[model samples]
Target: MKKNMGNADRIIRVIIAAIIAALYYTNVITGTLGIVLLVLAGVFVLTSLISFCPLYAPFGIKTCPMKKG
Candidate 1:
């Protein structure tokens, strides 16, 4: 898939995911809410790594800089 996420977007997602993981591990967030957040964090990391967002594709949202080509 074409990269729909820019460097800033990827970095932000990673940072947010890290924060969620830390909160979950520390018990600041627990139970069902924590589990849901943890899953979302995993998705964030995955999308960041690939620089693609499935949701963005359907919406035609692209944060990456346009190619000059």
Candidate 2:
């Protein structure tokens, strides 16, 4: 799939993922809720690494800036 996420969007996802990981590791979040969030964080990291977000495709959203002519 083409990359629909911009650099800022990718960075934000990584930050969110890092926060989730920190909270989980620090025991600030535990059990089912934490597990679910951790999984989501993993997805965030994966998507950020690839610079693509599947959810954006069906919606026809494009966060990346277009190249100038």
Highest lDDT model number: 1
- Model 1, span 2-69: residue lDDT tens: 99999999999999999999999999999999999999999999999999999999999999999998
Clashes of each: 0, 0
Q: What TM-score do all the candidates reach, one by one?
A: 0.98, 0.96
Candidate 2 stretches with Cα past 4 Å from truth are none
Against the true structure, candidate 1 reaches a TM-score of: 0.98
Best candidate according to TM-score: 1
Per-model C-alpha RMSD: 0.5, 0.7
User: Taking the tens digit of each residue's C-alpha lDDT, what string does model 2 give over 6-44?
Assistant: 999999999999999999999999999999999999999
